[model samples]
Target: MMTGGPEPDSPDVMSVLELLAVGAPPARFEELLRTARREEAPDSTLAELDQAVRLASRVQALIGHAQQREAGLAALVDTAHDLTLVHGMEALLHEIARRARRLLNFDMAYIGLRAADDEGRASSIRAAEGETTSLSVGLKTFEDSGLGSLVQRSGAPAWSPDYLADRDLPHSPDIDAVVRAEGLHAILAVPLGYGTTVFGTLYGADRKVRHFTPDEISLMRSLGRLAGVAIERARLLEATRAEVTELELDTSRARSSLNVQRRVEAAYIRLIDLVLSGCDPQTLAEAAVKELSGALVVRDCVGRTIVVTGTPPRLTEDDVLRWTYDAHAAGCPVPMPDGGWVAPVTAGGENLGAILLVPDEPLTDGFGVRLLQLTARAVALILLLQRTSTVAHDQIRDELLDELLSDIRTQPRQLIPRARRLGIAIDEPHVMVLARPEGGPEGRAAAWASSYAHRMSGLMRFRDGYVTLLVPSEDPLAAATAVSEELTPLVGHPVTVGAAGPVSGPGRVAQAHREALSCLEALTELGNLGCVATPQQMGFLGVLLSENRGVGEYIRSVIGPVVDYDTQRFTELTRTLDAYFASSSSPTRAASDLHVHPNTVSRRLERIAELLGADWQDPERALEIQLALRLHRTRRTLQHRHAATGAARDAGSPAPRGSGP
Candidate 1:
């Protein structure tokens, strides 16, 4: 691209060339050809290009002077720094070499960094252009590579005027080829040193035979000295970097240790609190999630659990734990005796849940067995924390509901808005259900309870021991019944059941909660195992029966006359009617809840309508009856508990004998 320089024939150009040749070595003449350039130009442009070329050479000649070299050295030394270290050593060195070669006009150059051991050296063929991409310039070893060996073995600069002709060393096939093809008339190699250690070498090549001028040799020496100092600086910078790396590693370890220590301390405190409070596993779990998730920097930690032994309570859409049950049997991470950690979280060998700890780095030491063992212990503790937390959550739920039951019936209206304002969550048309384990550990039972509470209301262990939930969209009776069925597997024992009919309103939410609790308590046996109700499941009837303290007791008083009307008859009748009615919506499943053939349900419906003087053929009356049963069930549940369990329950419990919440 350059069109100026001394011309072959001009007097002024010859004169400058002559001065340049005064001490130029005959060994370097051909090498100059590789660096020199010529281009066609108009007469005036040629003149200007020649002037520019000569001017640059003149200026560069002065760079051999003391001051410029020093500045260059400082720049070279400073470049080995910063987050750039992320690139590792080889890439960093190559960048430096490439810049130096292009800047200094060296035909080719390389940096061979020596190692502490005599044979331990790592060097880069740092820069080469007019070369193939796959081409490599230096041999890897200290012994085979000339620049590497010279930098390590020689105490001073080494010159190879005729590289192939140099009898003192051996050459590889690639180097031999480079010597012949490059017309490499000579090479001047210099050792870059730090104190007594030869850290690396710097070299320049000549493509033709010519003598090196005094200034040329001086420039080479100057460049070499700068490179030597720069290499030493780079090494010191690198060494300090290594030290910083060690410090950072230590700091990271300390930080992680602090975090783990904090978690352990928190766990211990929780265990103590659980014991003192006599809270079951569900309660403990709820408390742990509230405390631990807040204390640590974990996201959505508690719900990603799978309960194998105990049936879990109803979960809403957002409860991740509901999905985890699908995961445990698929990919287990807990370790087995076969020497890998792959076992999942299980309570008493029953897969209760799987715990996940997502760390910025893999939780691996990548070191000795002792560190690995410590890692295992840490993981074990984490799993223990998750499992214990689940149990604690469930136990707290019933106790929580029991505590708040009184408030629900008193203020039946403040439900939805209260829930939203308190950061308590609710899904509309939601139903609430209650259950307690028959003969399981209080902790596990409670954990299941809290889990469902969270699932049903999207509320997790809020305030004292309460769990609010959001139920899915389905018929209220069907959904509540399904929830009860879903819970049996989680609690791992026979459980009672109660459910609220679907209704919307802040005030009415309390009514729903009470309904659920009452149903569960009153129907503790198989008579109401699958969302069925004895007279206990129905609303208050006579004045005498209605005057009773509890619906179950009231139901018992009226049920003596209907003793022969056992759970079976009720189950069959309800099943038939549900099937016949829901058949319009393809309610075969609803019929299943009633335990009857779909066709038989049709006939039962006709007979019932005939007896009640209502027309089964009339959709309106049929729907009314269904709604009434649902409401009856809902009312039964509410009579036993306060309606204010929903968010709006803040005012106070309503007086007794007010129409059911």
Candidate 2:
């Protein structure tokens, strides 16, 4: 504000000095030079002014460069912070691209991650920013692209002033087209990582031709390094999570296996306990069914049900048959329609039986199948044990029965006590039944008879090649008939049985046995195979065939003369007598029965009377004669049958030496 002559510090000069101190732009300093010339300043003053302007210009340039560097530093710091906050790779890459453009002031900036395919020959742009054109975020660069290829191959930062004209790196026509379309001339690219394991490339481009400075290239490399660290960290974290999940799954499976094994062990212990306790087959099966919460059925070798337990599904005979076949064939537990299982029970490689288990719920693992198999094994053992015990009991009973049927030397008092010990009530009214199997082995018939006798609470033995059973019954004939019917299927053929007495005491057993034997023989001689009979069933034939009957004395007392006449003259007087008695003594009926004339019948009867005496026509004598005739006829018939049997044997026998081949 000083006036008059110019002051030591003029306003214009002070303004210029202030601009120089503050390091203003070169243009401001140039204005100061113009002011100094227009005021016609001294040469030394002008020179000082020019020197100050020059110095200020240099200072201004340095300050601008420092400020730009500080701004770039701040942008880099922000990028690092943002990267830390980024969780996703795509987001992190996009943020890097955005920061790069803002810090470098580029026309376009993008990040490309290498494809994971073989050779990593291509890079796909994952993120982009500051694009004037419609920028495709995922633009891909080929193997021949100049910027991406040079950066990846060199594993360092790379750039080109004019990418289209560059010949130092491979050039791609498609990349060039995209670059031209985007109006991009200058490009800088840096590998995302070091060495051969580079993950991707980072790019910055300008629309105008430009020479990328070393500092700018270094900045791009820093961004690339930061992106690489993030990508690697994300991959490691994902891998760790996967490994942890797999470990947890393995631990869970191990625990499930342990639990199943524990349950199976407990089931096995329970089965052993049952066996040790001497529980019967039925009891063991019931326990298994209850523990398994299912239905259980145990069958014998013959397909007969030994034990059935629990609320099982209704099974038909056809279903049982099918299951048996399947179980036997598979030799393991077979799954059924109702979430059940079937297994064969075997011992000594013999199919002892079959077991069916139908659970309330489906078995999820092998534990249920294992349990069923163990149960079947237990059942097999029980069945085998029972069979052994049965054989032992049969042996003991057979011994006692033999002694009881022997000679009277073994007193009834001693026999009774032994029979009592064997669970037989010998003092009770009992019948002696003798069973003869037709066309069946004696051993098989004896064993079957013993089993049958045991079931009926009787005593049985194989004596003199005959299966004899001493049964407690009031009616011997009825008992014999019952046994015959039961033995039909067991023997697999016809069986003839003879029974005697409802004898009151053990002392009468011997007599009863003899009578039963006699009845059996009479049945054979009478051609009544497969028939059951008692001594009383033989009628008058019973007396003739009785063990105590005096056959010759009886015939002599009745038709003695006729028998003597036939013996001496070798005539058929006995046969004529038999015919007369069979026809009720009517001459005409007798002739018809003999196939002769009535007069011939009459003459034969006259001859019979002359030999037997005239009183033979009386009722008492006639009854005797009739009885005697039946005895003679039975004897004759038996002799004829014996002769025929001998003839048959001779016929059936092979011819001695000259037999035909």
Candidate 3:
């Protein structure tokens, strides 16, 4: 066989060549000797054999090196080209695995890519010539094994000199079996990085024990750089495609918005369903949640009977109180979930509950106001629909009014629920309201209400001709006189307002509301009031509570004990004991405020303490009684205030001061 070596026919030259077999520069010696023999000095044949053998030996070494280099270069170039041509990350990975196998001259090699979720996966593998492999394994997450973790964490370069001895690789009988099967003796894995961002890893292995050469490492690093470039190109292309997709999506959304308006008129149908179909609170909440959540990310959405401060699962009613947009707000997030946000609202400003959408991710540079407007409008529409529906219309109206007081017009007990939701302690002065616009239908009234509602973000109604003004004024007479004289000229029409004294919470709303309404009816003419009437004077609560004993029961369930206990622990007997003390006890103001004879007041005080327990002697308990007494007086005053207002409106007067604070 001709193995690219010299012929061995010459006689004496063979002896020389044989002698030179293990010497350095043997080819040069052979050439020198052959030149000498060509002169035919008589030893030419001997020299020829020596020269030919040396040349053959030199040629063999050169050919062997060239072959190894050729193999390595061809494998690397092919891998790069293949990876570049692959459609996706996985295909590139597979090609990498194949190349690693070929260039490593090893039995097994694996290629793993970085996962999006802070993980790495050995997703591709290849077996070298003469190596056996399992039929199943092609791709798997690194979380499946410690070896993968070690490779990923050690990001620089790693070597498992003896795969079996690698503690980090995990102990597996199967691993050893696989290693043996694949004929892997040593392994090296190097990280693939794009600039500073690590993308994945490249690995090489050999069947026989071998040192991973610096040259091999160098080549792999070059491949890594190539990988980075290719990946970046792919990423750029992907980004461009995503931008195009988003543009299309935005256009589709715009079209859908127009289409959505067509279905908006079907709100009446939804109202019917809500009323007749009996959607429970959970269902209603779920519906609201789904719409809000899917369309835009919101912090929370809640429809409430009482929009109070400390509430949860509800964005504050305060946000809706005076909002004027569509009377509502709704819109999807702008930019993207992570990048930016936007929202739009519908309902009229009169409808006061607000939707608050918040992105799960950080928003773009600036979009706070947009989010607010969008949420307000969207929530307003949804709530307005809930409110104006024939089903539970009165109840919805009452609740909406309560929520509206969160800030627009004035605070009321109806708003107490919201305060509670918002975690604010319930202790604000409040009043009842009653409104009747004599000359207008509901639509006209609503339009009129809008002007005022917008003025204060009235949370109750997303409409107009709304009654929103300070009620339960400390100076009810002064207020009446002022409103009569001032507002009459402005409205150019008569308006009478019934006022209730200070009150708070839904517990007392009805009581104050009925009286106010009565007072309003008593005034046949709307001659001077800025507002028709407030709930305090309407005094609807006492009657409503009498009919709905459950209302009292509910209140008792929530906070009755404190009121009852404090009343007894603090009030009765102390009144009688006060006379016994005989001290003047700040009598001048007390008498003036009480409008009672000092002697009579003194006698009543004496009677109070006698009934109280001996502990009543304690000054603290006296103060407690004083407080309870004040509370009772306040309630009665509220009840009585409506009549006082009626007297004022009857006389067609107003308070002297300007209503604007």
| Number of the top lDDT candidate | 2
Say which candidate scores most in TM-score: 2
Off by over 4 Å in 2: 1-269, 290-293, 299-306, 312-374, 383-396, 436-451, 462-467, 490-498, 514-661
lDDT of 1 by residue, 1-661 (tens): 3223333433334434553555343222322332233333356644654574455465446544536545543443333222123234555456555654554465665665555564545554554443333444653544565644564565556666677777786666666665576666567666665323455666666665545454344445444444444444344335434633554566567885555444444454454446334444444444443432311111122344321212232335333344444434543443222222222333222333443322223334422222222222233333433333332233233223433334534444434454554344433555554444455444444445445556555332222122233353435456555655665565445655455645444444456666555555566533554343322335452111222235344433432222223253663443344454555645456556666576665565555555445553466645545554444456646755555343234556544454334
List the lowest-lDDT window of 10 residues for candidate 2.
Answer: 2-11
The global C-alpha lDDT for each of the candidates, from Candidate 1 onward, is 0.45, 0.72, 0.45
TM-score of each prediction? 0.28, 0.38, 0.30
Model 2 scores what on Cα lDDT?
0.72
Alpha-carbon shift of residue 82 in model 2 (angstroms): 89
Question: Residue 233 of candidate 1: its Cα lDDT?
Answer: 36
Candidates ranked by TM-score:
2, 3, 1
Worst 10 residues of 3 by lDDT: 300-309
Give the per-residue Cα lDDT of candidate 2 at 335: 86
Q: Give the per-residue lDDT of model 2 (tens digit) for 69-94.
A: 55765666566556655555667677
